[model samples]
Target chain A: MAHIHLGEGSFPLWALVLWTLLGVGLISAVVYRVRKGGIKTHQIALAGIAAAASFAIFQLNIPVWGGIHMNLTGLVGILAGPLLGALIALVVNIFSAALGHGAVGLLGANTLVNASEAIVAYYAFKTLIGMDWDVFPASASAATLGLSAGAFLMGAIIVVSGVNGSALPRGDLTIAVAGLVGLNLFAAFLAAGYWGFTVTGGAMPWAKRSAKALQRGVQEGGGALVELGRGIVVAGPIRKGGLMVEFGALVLVLGVLGIGLYVYVDRYGGFEDGERPAR
Target chain B: MTVTTLSNHVPDPRLVTAFAEQRDGPLHRVNPWTKIGIVGALVLAVTVFDRLALLAGLYGAVLVVYGLAGLPYRRLAGWYTLPLLFIVSVAGPLTFLEPGTPIGGTLPTPLGELSVTWAGIVLFAELSCRSLTVVTFALTASMTTKYTDVAYMLGRLLPRPIDQIALLTYRFTFVMLETLEDLVKAALSRGANFSEFWSNKRLYARILGMTMLSAIEQSERLVKSMEARGYNGDITLYGDVSRPPIHELFVVIGSYVAVVGYAAVAVYGVRQ
Candidate 1:
């Protein structure tokens, strides 16, 4: 779910051009970096996995109040690295918008945000991992940081991009944009929470513990109730050509497949997971 | 084993299949990149949406485009509804939240004073319509064109490695989806209920966690299968991506020209 849905005419022609150029430029750089590294065999497989995972993870919905979704750019970045992550973000953005997962017009801006998130998160996670931090802590911090940056990037696009005068007066548009920024932050926080828990809380003892907590939640009328209620309200429409369910479900599935494909692609080249590359 | 039974429950992967195809509509006949250019040019022209009449006209144009494409309204309704909701959520709140020409009267609340403004409501309508305009244009291009065509277009447009990434992403995306389906089925077989999974977040997470672990393990196994099949770094599309037929190309170009003419008039002549 897109936090900010900037409609048409929000940004001027030059601004849209600028953003597209910026996005294209960044993607080119990432691609250049990938090729220059002389990765011939398993690296391509890893990149594919990275793209698949990024797209899939971006589709998971937490169903929190009014429903929030996690893009998992941070996690994808960590798994796939910067070059692949950047390309993946652009592809996922195209798929999401086309498939009706996010706003279509905002694809360029959103791609920029995703690219930035992947790059930022990749570096941050790698730095932490290099410092010998545990995977859990590194993932959490990177996720929070990446997603927070993403939230603000969305805000910046919302603020600077479109024409507000046509809607309300300039003053009111400013306040509306500001409110959207706040909304983005809040949504990002919830998504980050979902992600942090998924990796850290999903492990053996933690998984068992979390499952109990979830059971209690289901029984106690918490987020579980929210999902059930949302499902009831939306499921009927969802079945009748609603791409939301299809999107979220497929993306997650693709994510799993991406990882599996990556493993396969790598192994096909006689590369082991542990021996992947120094990244 | 319950595995056989559980597999029966997996929903048909329709959305992907739906997207991977090109419908035989007037619009679908155009090469994806040309339509993409048309969509892009229109999206860039969104600045003219400042006027209500122009905004409505653009929307009407999208409806006409849909009609010309021979696409079904019911098939596209779901896409339309989301932007409507987005408008309400985003623009609706502006009426009460932003200070402007009040509609009726102000209300006193614990949070503070709240007034639904005329200008704010209008602004919401305007912005929401604007969002609708761009979304519709993008959706039309996406719905009418094939995903493979778009990816190939992207590959041709972008530099080398990026093109490779685009192609690989397309190929691997389906593989990943199939893998995910199997995982979900396996999860379902092992005492996980679909209704219960949806109802409970933590349990879903627990299952997701298992999937995540399996994802790591599966990657390893997949490499073996891929290696056996002679895996390489390159991705190959099965067939050549066709260009738009001349008539379709002309139609798309003519539309883009009209859009540009309208936008130019709106931005320079009328607005000035």
Candidate 2:
């Protein structure tokens, strides 16, 4: 979901080298750990299958956000251990790059983005499970958190590497990336929130009741904002609705923040006509 | 879109493998290592050269080589869609953002005045060339090189379990893809509609979850079968890639030297 789709030469040579070296370092450590620990055969099989599934699903576009594919790196991390999950990330990226889905030059950067997702998701899922959380909530939350981490990491990578030939200053680029990452996080949260709401069977009833109350309040000359605030604070019969409300507020905030950053970059990002930054 | 339709748009591993195995062109006979080395050189060259003419020339040369290799030009053009989309998305904003002599008069936008500059157009073209050059060559290499050679190369290049996993994954991706296709078909036949994401989020999640569960079970069965065959953990590929010939080696070296020399001159202003 957070894959960097930039083609070759999008990053400068130094940034490319830096990311490639970091990527190599990561894979080297993973390899060393696997060699020292000696993986079980069953785990190897699982990793192999997980990689296949992840790669296949990476291309499978679901009807979301006008056709987007899910990474499933989170699920890969949970199913295959982190060590193997990280390896799977490398494998998937290699295959994808080979097939021209991603740039061969950005393999290192892309690998880092994806491997982090799997690693974070694995640990997050484990931690949540350890905390006695239900499987659905724990997995969903962990996946969302993991994907969010990937999105932020991707943003950082683009900001640090800096797009070649882009006229935007580092500051403006950071703002643009922040906006993009914010939007990505918003989508992740919205999907996770909706998934949670539907699975828990608490959102529909509460949402319907809230809608009626909101309409009544508006008809009675009360503002929709007042009704929304009331709905948030009321804490109705469905306790899970609180989680949805929290998710709703978060999604709204992220959406606003993302759009605001885009607007900010558009208006004041130093792209004024006929004015070039002093190189 | 349904999985079946969407699958058509994606680069099919099967088609890639078919091209690699069936094509008996000059490139097909070349050593995988040589092709891989050339790919590396191309990457370096594209990374170093920023001039629009040089980039376009490089892209033109790559396309000629691709054509010479007996690869399908039509399919190659088709495959350009993703890279093109990526280039536009990243560089699209730059066209308006880069300051230069505006090609068209600035238009009033909600955020500010917007105009495409000559410099911005040049930037976009350069980026597009850089992206497509690598993408085209990468596809050329993959299509020309057989999957067994690829698996063998991975086995030699990567470490123990990583190599093993990659090899297995490459083979099983087809199986999993088939399974996924079947699942999608079954869902569609059972009146499952995936046209809307928000409304069908549950169905999407369920289909994905089912695929995961099936993969887990498939892996369990695979483990038992492999264990029965005395497989301990190592997966060995019998196929091997021959070392690059001396001339090919020189060509590869010459390409690298050319890139290094170009970079020194282009970037550092080093005199020949």
Candidate 2: tens digits of C-alpha lDDT, residues B1-272: 12244444457787777888888989999999998899899888888786889999999999999999999888777678778877876677777777778886899989888899887788889889999898889988999998889999988987788788898889888888878878778888999887887777766766666666677778879999989889977785786788899999999999999999987876646674
The prediction achieving the highest TM-score against the true structure is 2
Give the Cα error of residue B176 in candidate 2, in Å: 0.5
In order, what are the TM-scores of chain A for the candidates?
0.63, 0.70
The digit string of per-residue lDDT tens for model 1 on A147-240 reads 7777678766655543444333446556766677677666555555554545464455554543333222122210110123345321111234
Per prediction, the TM-score for chain B is 0.72, 0.91
Docking class of 2: acceptable
Residues A43-64 of candidate 2 have per-residue lDDT tens digits of: 7887888788887776677766
Per-model DockQ against the true two-chain complex: 0.17, 0.37
Q: Which candidate leads the pack in lDDT? A: 2
